[model samples]
Target chain A: MVGYLLRRIGMAVLVMFVALSVNFAIPRLMPGDPVEQQLAAVSAAGGQTGDMAEAAAAMRARLGLDRPLAVQYLAFLANSIRFDLGVSVASYPQPVAEIVLAGLPWTIGLLGTATLLSFVVGSLLGAMLAWPRAPKLLKFLALPVVVLSAVPYFILGIVLMALLGILWPVLPVAGGYPFGMVPNADFATALGIAKHGVLPGLSIVLASLGTWAVAMRGMVVGVLGEDYIMLAEAKGLSERRIFLAYGVRNALLPQFTQLALKLGLLVSGAILVEVIFAYPGIGYRLYVAIGQKDVFVVQGIVMLLSLSIALAMLLLDLIYPLIDPRVAARSA
Target chain B: MSALAVRGLCVEFASARGIVRAVQNVSFDLAPGERLGLVGESGSGKTTTALSLLSLIRPPGRIASGEILLDGVDIARATPSALRRMRAARIALVPQGAMNALNPVLTCGAQFADLFAAHGAPGGTARIAKLLASVGLGVEVATLYPHQLSGGMKQRVCIALAIALRPAVIVADEPTSALDVIVQKQILKTLLAVQRDIGAAVVLVGHDMGLMAQFAHRIGVMYAGRLVELAFVRDIFATPRHPYTRMLIDSLPGFGARGVFKGIPGLPPSLLTALPGCSFAPRCPRAGPRCTVEMPQTRILEGGGEVRCHDA
Candidate 1:
């Protein structure tokens, strides 16, 4: 088991390295020179019309753009390992790491909870719908959820914003929390965050819940067909126990793998929902970075998301046997 | 009273074409400690017959009509709750496909715990260990999952589970068929040994006539959901009455027994649409005009047992 985990960790490192290298290369491949753009903007801000070429040269040298491509790539690799993404070309003064981290909590707080909530609630409901004598109405629930999953996350976010935010006015339309509200360990502040999150979080959950539920439903139906289920019945296990132990437990195995893969994406937040809600999150920050061609911030966020996904998947694979005895025995 | 008696048991499945009468008017009785082997080809409804005895048939297929009398009560007429009670406690099934018979993710001990708990019986480690030991398995095997065990070992665990509650009847549906020849004999011996200790009447289902001859004191031959003949181990082997039973006995590849190897000709009739006469008519060499036009009634022999044939 220890060896297995070590192997996974090694693979995670290799995966992250490749992802980070791609993150570095993509920005360099972009059309405009962000350093020149920053230089031009900085000179304009200082109200100086002198030495534009010299200023551009100084900016390029300071940002390591004056070095050879190989040396710059090596420097980028080293800086990335230390989480030392340079200052954003769009914001010019703000460090990309600091800016990205500022949005991390909102994304984790809203999208993370929503994503987990969708899996938990969706899987339970899906298992119920797939129950041996499940109600006719329960089977019909797949229709709306399928439709919701079919709608693009952003479109769902927009529709939710329009209906709940504008028409009903039941929840806040934008932002992670109340403006100027300090999110200390107080009921009022937490409630404020949840209230503001309702519309955007609902948008994400609605879109994601359907997919998880649908997947879980299919898995449960398949598990029910297995011969062990027949043997379980022949053994006289009560319907409820069989449903949980024989049906749901085995069915949840694939879902756990899916959940592990989705964890990294959740950290990035549902980009559309975050944008529609104007919620300050990593996804929204990534969007702004792309629009202004803030290469450093984009690279930092991408690297973080990729590293998180790889490491999380490794952890999930390592932890899989603890929950599933079949995998445990096989791995052993 | 018999240990278990099934009367007019009819099982059917609603498929796209129509209802398939899987088991039709099947009636049989098993006395305490008696071993009855149900033998036939695939889709002969042996497995379905075994499953329906405990009301274990699932949707699209049901015991349409039957009286599964155990302890003088009709299990077929039993409610869902009563049927649940009968399962594992009143009667148990050593289901086919032992490898897949167990919950793959559960340890052998956990499975025993489930069966014992359902029957309101004790299932601590010590009791389970003793049960495992009876089947020639070690206590350590209780900790291992199904995948960790070989085919024979899994079958042994299945035997242990069936005897856990010590029900009056233990139905083993093709318990040893999944195993290789050597392992098949070993598993069969384990099943018989465990049956002796538990004192449960055994219902062994299989197509291996030789194995059944070895284990079963009486054998029942089913053809297309109908019990063609059921007689003593001595009678069925020596002087089988039913043409189907005789053919089954004759077809056994025996050592040094030389005759032209005559396999039963033609397929068993489909149960989707009704067969006007005997399902075995097309396959039976002794099939006559009456056999082709009219379904033969079961005849009770003076010696013992019954046969459904025009020329029995």
Candidate 2:
């Protein structure tokens, strides 16, 4: 077990390095000057009357953008390892670390809850629907699940917003929390935050539940045909018990890898939903940084996101063997 | 009373093409401590009949009609809960390909423990250890997963699991077919010994006439979803009354008779269409016109056996 964990941690470090490098390199390599764009925005608003050239030069030097690419890359890498992300240009005068830290809790609270809820509910429904002797009605029900899963989250998010938000005035339309109610360390504040989080969380669930159901359905179908499941049935286990204990448990292993991928991918993909709802999450912060060319803030947030995914993937890899003894024995 | 008695059992499967008569009017009886061999080629519906006995066929498969009486109680008429109680405790099955039948993610001991727990057996772990040791596996094997074991070892674990509950009857469906020849013999020996020790009736399903002759006290030949012949093991091997049975016995390769064994000619009929007469008539060289016109009645031989052919 120790050996396996060590090996996984080693792989995680390599992955984190690659993720950070790509995150740093992509924005830098993009065509056009981010600083110039920011300057243009400032000048358009008629806020700056100083020499444009000198202002640009000073801004570039202060942000280390004028430094040699190699030196800047090295500095960024070192700063990332130490968690020393610089200040944001978009939200000027704010530290990048503070912005990320503020947003982390919301994303984790919303997405984590959605992921777990969807997995449990979807897997149970799928297992029931995939039984060899299930009625035609059950099979028909699975068809909608497959279709919904195939439809992209953005499309579903929009449809949900239109119908649930606009058509009916029952649910909150946009934003993570109510306006002017900043989250504070208090019971009332926590309760308020949870209440505000419900709508955005529901949107995420509505957008992704279909895919989870479809994937779980296929997994259950495959697991139902396995010999061990037959043996479980032959042992006189009730159909329900066999379905839940043996069938669903074995089927969930395959879904675990997909779940890990989905969680990691959500770090980036959450941007669309975050923007749609104007949720104060990491994704929304990222959007604002990119628009203002806040290089330091972008670098900091990207590194944190990448590091979180890397850590999660590492934990997932290490934990799999506990659920699946075959993997443990093989690794041993 | 016999442990299990099946009379006029038939199973049919509905498919897009048509209804398939997978098992037709199959009848058999197993007395306490009697070993019965159900011999047939692939698709002969032997497995379906076995599954029908337990009322466990998956859809679109259904037991159209049957009377499965266990110890004078009609199992076919039993409620679902009653049937579940009877399974594993009263009648257990050691299915075909036992090597892959174990849960890959569970330790062998844990799998055995699960079997005992399912049946509500007391002292599960200790009982599992005893069962494993009885099947020629060491106690250490309990901690190992299925994938860590060889094919023979896995089969042994399956046997241990099947006998864990000490069910009155154990159905082993082609249990040794997946193992090598030597391992097959060893596993078969272990199975017979276990049966002897427990005094449980065993239903051994296989196509090997020679192996059946050596282990089975009684042999029943199935062809095209119907039983063609049944007799004592020696009688079936020494003098097979049905032509299909004769062909199957003769098809077995003889020792040192290289290149001389003739395979059975013609294919088994598809079960989708209604079977007009004797299901095996099209493939039987000695089939008469009457065999093609009407289904033959099962006739009892003077030596105490049955054959489902007009000529016999």
Candidate 3:
């Protein structure tokens, strides 16, 4: 077990290293320099201080852009290790790490809850859809689930926004919470945040629920044909036990793997949904950073996304054996 | 009273072609602790008949009309709750393909626990260990998953599970078909030993005639969903009454005999479109004109056996 864990961790570290290198390289490969872009934007906005050459040179020195390429690379690595992601080019003087930290919780709370909710509810629905003993009404739900799964989440988010946020005016249309309300531990604050989250979260859950249900239904159908299922029924186990322990439990293995991968990509994958709602999450920040050419913040967010994906995969590897012993035996 | 009794059991499947009668009027009475083997080629409905004993025939297929009496209760028409109650407690199954017959995620002990718990009985660790031991498996084997065990070992676990509640009847459908020949003998021995211990009548379903000859007290030969002949093991090999049964015996690789293996001439007729006469007429070498126009009546034989043939 220890060996398996160590091997998985090693692989994750290797993946993170490659992702970090790619994150560093992509922004540098972009059309324009961050310092030049920031200066040009400021000048366009009619903000002037001194001569261009002196100001640019001073800015380069402060931002450590004046150093040799190798020195800058090493410094970048060191800073990243310490979670010091330097300053944002668009929002000058604001640390990239601070911005990421601010947005992290909102994205994690929204997308994490959405993913988990979709998996559990959708899987149960799907399992029921395949089960012969489940209600006919649940089986009828398969059609709507298939149609909804095909619809993109952003489109659903926009539709939900127009419906509940505008026509109905029942839900908050934009942002993580009402503007001017300071986020705190109070129940009212938490409730407001959750209320604000309903639209975006609903769109995500509605859109992805179908995929999980369809996949789970397929898996459950296949599992139902297995010899174990037949034996389980023959053993006189209750319909619930056979459906859960024997049928759904076996069918859920691949679904869990898919869930882990989805969670790993959650922050970045929710970009469009976040943008649709004007929600202040990591994905929303990523969108703004890209628009403003804030390279450090973009790189920080990308790096964080990659690191999280690796971590999620690592965690899956560790727990997979616990759920399915065949994996552990094979790895061993 | 018989431990298990089947009368006029008919199972049909609704396929694209038509309703295929998989099992037709298959009746048998299993004495207490008796080992009855149902042997036939693939698609002969032996497995279906075994599953019917547990009321486990799934969709597109169902028991059209029948009575599966276990402890005088009609399993074919039992309520779902009553059926569940009788299952594993009054009748358990040792399924075919033991390699995949167990839930791979659950340990042997947990699977055993489910069988016990489902029946509203406490499955103590000591009882589980004893059950495992009865099937020639060690106590440590209960802690392992199905994938960790070999094919023979998995079948042993399945056997152990079947007898866990000491059900009056145990239906074993080709339990050792996935194992090697050597392992097959060991598994059969383990199965027979366990059945003896529990005093459970077993309906062993398989196509391996040799295994059936050794392990079963009475062997029923099915052809095209009909019980063509059922006789004691010695009588089945000695004076096989039905032409199809005789041909099956002749096709077997006989002891100390050097001859070309003679396979039955043709495939069994499809059950679709209502087979008019004896379903085995096309395949039987001694098929007569009467056999083509009329279904044979099931007749009792002097040797305490039964044969379904007009000439018999």
Candidate 4:
């Protein structure tokens, strides 16, 4: 088991390396100079007047944009390994790593809770609906879930904001917490932060719960036909016990892989949700970094997201054997 | 009183095509410690009847009408909680293809332990070890997962699990089908010995009439959702009443007895649409005009046997 985990971790590191290298290369290769654009904006705004060639050269040199691509790639790789992402290009004084760290907790607080909640709710509902005697009401309840799952998260977020925020005025339209509310350095402050995080957290849950419900429903239906479930029934187990112990447990095994993969990919969508809610999260910071062409900030956020995904997948790979001994024995 | 009595049992399924009858008006009584072999071709409703006895049929299949009396208690009308207690504790089933029925994720010991746990029986390491040993498996077998065990070994585990509660009746649905000939004999022997030791009624369902003749005291032949013939094991072999039963016995290739073995010709009838008369009329050599228009009711013979046929 240890050896298998080590192998998976090794593979994940290689994948992360390849991912970050591509992330670094793509922006540099894109047509147009972000520094030049910033300089042109500054000049247009009448902030400064200087020789055009010298100013362009100074801006390029200052941003370290004149170096060879290979040199810059190696330096970025080294810095990435040591968790040293260079200063923000748009916000020159601040370090990228610091900015990302400050915003990460908010994103995790919202998306992470939503992910867990959706999986649990969806999986349970799916199991119930998979029952042969399940009422038509459940099917009716499930139709909306399928429709909602097909709708993009941003659209759902917008609809929810428009309905609940604008029409009903029940929730705050934008922002993670109330204005000027600094996080206190104690448990009470943490509680307060969680309390204020409800609407943004619920927005994510409402958006993603349908997909999980559909996936879990399909999983339960497939599992219901397995030989072991028949055996469970033959053993004279109560319907409820069989549903929970045998049916749900076995059905959820395949979903674990889906859940793990989603956990990693979800960071991308978290940015949009964070923006919608005006949440101070890594995704929000990433959006700002992209707009300002802050290479260092973008690199830091991308690497962090990549590492998180890799770690989650690695954890999932390890967890598979514990849930299913067949995999463990095969690998062993 | 009989150990178990099933009367006027009719199981039907509401399929998209129509209301498909799987088991119709099947009636039988099992004596204490008696082994009854339920013989039939596939889709002849033998397995369906066994499932109906336990009320294990899931929807859209249901027991439209039936009375399953276990030791004079009507199990068909029992509450879910009552049914749960009756199962395994009173009546158990060694399900068809049970070799693949074990939980793949759990160790054999854990699976057995769960069976005991579900029944509120005492489950400890020592009890599990003893149970494993009883089934001709070593203590090490308990630590292994289902995949690690061979087909025969898995079947043995399944048998051990079924008999764990020492129920009054054990319904085995083709228990030896997946096993090799050698393993088949061994499993049958083990099952016979266990049944004898517990003094329980054993209901064995299979297509192989020869195997049934060897173990069962009484044999019930089913054809297309109806019990056509049921007699003492000796009588069933000596004077087979139903043509289907006769064909099934004749088809068994007798060792060193050279005679052209005639396999039963014609397929079983479909149960989706209601048959006006006899289900086996299409295949029966003696089938007449009346056989096509009117269903034959079961008739008790003078010689302690039952046959459902117009000519009988």
Those runs of model 3 whose alpha carbons end farther than 4 Å from true positions after fitting are A28-69, B255-259
- Candidate 4 scores an fnat of 0.67
Where does candidate 1 stray beyond 4 Å?
A: A29-57, A140-142, B256-261
lDDT of 3 at B196: 89
lDDT of 1 by residue, B137-227 (tens): 9999999998889989988988888888888999898988788999999989998898898889999999999999899999999999989
Task: Give the count of colliding residue pairs in each prediction.
Answer: 0, 0, 0, 0
> Which is superior by lDDT, 3 or 4?
3
Ten contiguous residues minimizing lDDT sum, candidate 3 chain A: A20-29
- The order of the candidates by DockQ, greatest first, is 3, 1, 2, 4
Residue pairs in candidate 4 whose N, alpha carbon or C atoms collide under 3 angstroms: none
State residue A161's C-alpha deviation in candidate 4, in Å.
3.2
lDDT of each: 0.87, 0.83, 0.90, 0.84
Q: After superposition, how far is residue A219 of candidate 1 from its true place, in Å?
A: 1.1
Error of 1 at B96 (Å): 0.6
Put down candidate 4 lDDT per residue, B1-312, tens digits, no spaces.
789999999999998899989999999999999999998888889998998778888878999998999967788788887888888889988878766788877788888887887789987878877766777888888889999999988988888888888999999989998888898888899899888988999999998887888899999999999999999999989888888888888888978568777788889888998889898899999999999999999999978899999887
How is the predicted docking of candidate 1 categorized under the CAPRI scheme? medium
- TM-score, each model? 0.95, 0.92, 0.94, 0.91
Q: Rank the candidates by lDDT, best first.
A: 3, 1, 4, 2
If both were scored by DockQ, which would come out higher, candidate 3 or candidate 4? 3
| lDDT pick, better of 2 and 4 | 4
Ranking by TM-score: 1, 3, 2, 4
**Candidate with the greatest TM-score versus the true structure:** 1
lDDT of 1 by residue, A71-128 (tens): 9999988988888888987887989989988998888888778888999988987898
Q: Please, what are the lDDT tens digits per residue for candidate 2 over residues B1-312?
A: 788999999899999999999999999889999999999999999888877766778778888888989866677778888888888788888878776798887788888776667667784566777888899988889999888899999999888877877889988889999989999999999999999998899988998888989999999999989998999988888899999999888888878667797888889999998667888889888988999989998899988899999988
The residue pairs that clash in candidate 3, if any, are: none
